[model samples]
Target: MPPTVGERAPDFESLLCTGETFRSTRLDEALDGGCVLVFSAFSFSAIAENWWKRYERAGWADFDVPVLGVTRDGPYAQNAFLRYLESPFRLFSDVDGRVGEAYDLLVEREGMANTTTSWRAVFVLDADRTVTYAWVADDWISPVPREEVEEAVAQL
Candidate 1:
């Protein structure tokens, strides 16, 4: 099950495009004075990146907190995806979905052959690493309502 609203978040370490390492344990260190939004992708969904860019341009990055883009792909693939979408947020590789699994956000095929794609999900975490908001998109084309995230962060 996912962490409850007031529960401590699970910590995870993953590689990022910045050549730096990250994990939920370091969330507070990264956000110190700001909030964070973890955007998880199903695969190569550029739409998600587009939505985040809107927030980035709207001054979300000005908060100085890290907005992490998490995926199951490695840093090499993530680099390509970010470059193609002109994404500003750093991408973190979940590789085998351990992080997703810990958060109860892992979505894998039941009987399909060798499928590894994860379901699209988003989680907003405060500097304390507690999950403040969560959403799972129903489809690849579904957009993450900007105000929903903004309003969540505004609360922090």
Candidate 2:
């Protein structure tokens, strides 16, 4: 199971597309701001492209809060998809699937190898880095609705 509401989110360092990095812990001295994190199977997948495009068109990207996504793909895939969409959003690569496993979203499906990817999921972390919301898919087929995710983030 994923971390539940009111729980402390695990601290993680991710390799971003820019060759820089992002860390999630919100310590008093940390510069990394809080954000709503979304974990997807792959950034360049057709379903992910459509899902994010629709979310962007709806103006949800301008929500008065930080929002980002995590994907199993590496920096190369993310960089290509970022250009293809030209969206300002950045996707942090969980190429090793460590973050997904920590969040309890990595599992072995019927035919897929264990720890190979993450299920589609969404998480809202407050400015203090506590989880305000969490949603994990039972499987990786359907898209997670952006409106529902925005609703959860709005609560913070």
Candidate 3:
């Protein structure tokens, strides 16, 4: 099962596509004094880009909560997608799907492995790595509305 609202979030590290060597970011460390929003997606997909744009444009990054984008794509594709969207948030590469599997966000159906790729999902985590909210979309085009994320952060 996926992490629930009150459950502890799984901590994982990934490579950032910052051109230099990938940096390690521990979820618990990142949220040591604030909340975090983790978005799991396939790079540059319409829904992912659109939602990320909205959230960033709203200045969520400047707030106490940090937003993270995690994807199964390698650093190359992830960097390209971030450049295309002009997103300031760092994107994490989960090429092995270990991060997604740890969070139980991988969905394999009809012999197609969305787990091996990326599907739209979001997790809100508190400072101690406890999950405050979690959402995994059934369709790539659908995302938890921006307000929901805002509310989650506010609640944190």
Give me the candidate number with maximum TM-score.
3
How well does model 3 score by local distance difference test?
Answer: 0.73
Worst lDDT 10-window in candidate 1: 18-27
How good is model 1 by TM-score? 0.75
Misplaced by over 4 Å in model 3 are: 18-21, 109-115
Reference-based TM-score of each model: 0.75, 0.82, 0.84
What is the C-alpha lDDT profile of model 3 across 1-156, one tens digit per residue?
Answer: 778888988888777665333566676655645565555667766767777787788787876777777887788888778778777777788888888888777766446655455457777788887788777777767656667777888887
Question: How well does candidate 2 match the true structure in TM-score terms?
Answer: 0.82
In the order shown, what is each candidate's alpha-carbon RMSD?
Answer: 3.4, 3.3, 2.5
lDDT of each: 0.64, 0.72, 0.73
Which ten-residue region of model 2 has the weakest summed lDDT? 23-32
lDDT of 1 by residue, 1-156 (tens): 666566667766666664343333444444554455464654365665566666678776665456776677777777776676566677767788877777776665556567554556666777668777776766655767667777777777
In model 1, residue pairs whose N, Cα or C atoms come closer than 3 Å (at least 3 residues apart or on different chains), thus clashing, are none
Where is model 2 more than 4 Å wrong at Cα? Answer: 18-33, 109-115
lDDT of 2 by residue, 29-116 (tens): 2323457777888887887898768768877668766567778888778878877887666677888888888888876656655646
Q: How does model 3 score by TM-score?
A: 0.84
